[model samples]
Target: MSHGPFQAQPTTKAALENVAGQLRQVLGLEKVDFFPVVKVLEFGLPSIFENFVFRVKEGPAMGDQHGLTFPDDSEIWLRDDVYEGVTQGKGRDRFTAAHEIGHLLLHSQRFLSRRMGDQPIRTNCDPEWQANCFGGCLLMPAILVKTCKYIDEVMDRFGVSRDAARHRTKQLNLSMQEVF
Candidate 1:
């Protein structure tokens, strides 16, 4: 949901989960539920990859937007408030940072080379949806969530908002009696 437009890149939720897991491994956080998403935005990713930039921009008002990523530019921008909230461990802002990281990892121009055409955009092939899928998997990892006994457990253990944990329940199609 950060970028304006991107070429279709066919992918599945399973694929995005794998990507997020790999990123966690790269960040040495494979076994942890909560890793600092803002720290990754500020240091981890940019340090791991060349020319990748993360900035907290002050001006032009981002309005409702929490953060945005320019995949082609290898840059991620956070509105000042978003950055502040994320550093303070606000669940929503953490997801926003993770979401922007998802966009960077999944939607770089080189990775999605097909130009826009007359084809109808499918959700599975959408850049924004893909990023959401990735971000969800990264924050509320399926393996960990599967072990939780209830919704509040997912929210507490994963350090994500209730909305995010509910979305995960839907995405994973878990039994509502257990996780709904």
Candidate 2:
């Protein structure tokens, strides 16, 4: 649950709730719609909906684009064409939106806050990792992740992809050595 050098943070579930609160404050977002972002992109529903994205791009290719913030006017963008080409159904779409929200809440702060010793902080942390963590806790709470017997079981219940399910498993600190 705890991350960072000191493990000063609370569990990922608590952190996500905090993020959701902050999101409401910063973006005036009222709820976790999981559809608006996709609607904005104009992507249609595909039969197989994986709750995550698997990028063919080299390196870590998951989650959404970054650099959005609380005060900034920058909007989270999803071109309709791009969305249509990439993902499947509403579940997948919602997951992607939640993932982007993760980056905005988790990764954005490193860029916003000043570090001790005045050294420039780095974007070294994986945005995908943060987002996956957020999405897992948001989509499926820690209790479910802990109790679920298999990723496929989680996937069937949540209507998400196997990859998303696996990502959620790891993010929640669940054991995926068997399922994956």
Candidate 3:
């Protein structure tokens, strides 16, 4: 029995950490360093793009779709609302961009490989979940998350939203006993 489209493997914690570590090393980021989004997008993505052009397009209303990554052309499209949020320093927008980047890093190769064959492409695992997990890992690395005393600290240090920090704290099995 032949499996239909090549299902991309779900990323593990170790895999996420490895990727995060590589990104940190490439960017010269320390444990508590906040990711410089523009630098990462402009400089870091180029290293992965090879000959493909990496561009960010600010489009009209995307409704709930904050960002999208098209690996075929190495492009990321961000909704106007999302772009505004990024300029205003909203953490959700940052996470959304990072999530798109996550898709480029984690799914692009699998998508390319699937297209090479005659199989109808399908995802066995939820790509959104994988990308979301990757976004969390990338923005709030375990090294810093482990040292945080409160969710607010994670939010402040990583520039992540309260929800993101809370979820990450839960993932790390950290208690949210403090009032703050």
Candidate 4:
């Protein structure tokens, strides 16, 4: 969405979506109406994913970034502001956390392949796109969004921003009216 994928990845949106669904199932969030993203960032990552989550102070370290994942160190750094917002159930900040989680999962040493600058940028190979797609899928799962009749319902039930909910609903086209 904004930047990233310094390297090319071997995956597609459908693959990332499947990964998100499977991750939800693994985390026992498949049936959860509102996935507790903050809890997952704080506790679940260390226990389940074994990646350390840190709420870092705003400074040169993480300038303009809500969150950053360092797969090499098995660590995730979230800006203090974003972390605070997440505690208050802010949807955009929660999406940032999910996006970092996506990086940790999909761009690890096991999957990273540095790409030359001369190569053309492709959607499926873009790490940023993958993380965004993953975040959307994880936060607003199609099955969950399909159960919603209105955009407000999606935003409220999924604890997502209006824009994110709208994008998910539009992506699914659940054949239901999307009243804003």
lDDT of 3 by residue, 63-139 (tens): 55677776666777677777667666689998987888777777765443343566544433456666787788889
List the candidates ranked by TM-score, beginning with the highest. 4, 1, 3, 2
User: What lDDT would each prediction earn against the true structure?
Assistant: 0.82, 0.47, 0.71, 0.79
Candidate 3 — worst ten consecutive residues by lDDT sum?
A: 1-10
Q: Which parts of model 1 have CA positions greater than 4 angstroms off?
A: 1-5, 113-119, 176-180
Q: Which candidate number would show the highest TM-score if scored against the true structure?
A: 4
Q: List, residue by residue over 137-177, the lDDT tens digit for candidate 1.
A: 99988887888778888787877888888899888988544
TM-score of each: 0.88, 0.47, 0.79, 0.89
Q: Which stretches of candidate 4 lie above 4 Å from their native place? A: 1-5, 175-180
Q: Which scores higher on TM-score, 2 or 4?
A: 4
* Residue 63 shift from truth in candidate 1, angstroms: 3.4
Give me candidate 1's TM-score against the actual structure. 0.88
lDDT of 4 by residue, 1-180 (tens): 236437646687678789999889988889787879878877777777554655666856778777888877778888888888888889998888888888878877667676667777787878888888899999988777888888888888988898888788777865455665
Winner of 3 and 4 under lDDT? 4
lDDT of 2 by residue, 10-124 (tens): 2345666566555433444334323244432233111112232322222223234321222132234443433453355545655665565555445534343323564433433
Give the winner by lDDT: 2 or 3: 3
Order candidates by lDDT, high to low: 1, 4, 3, 2
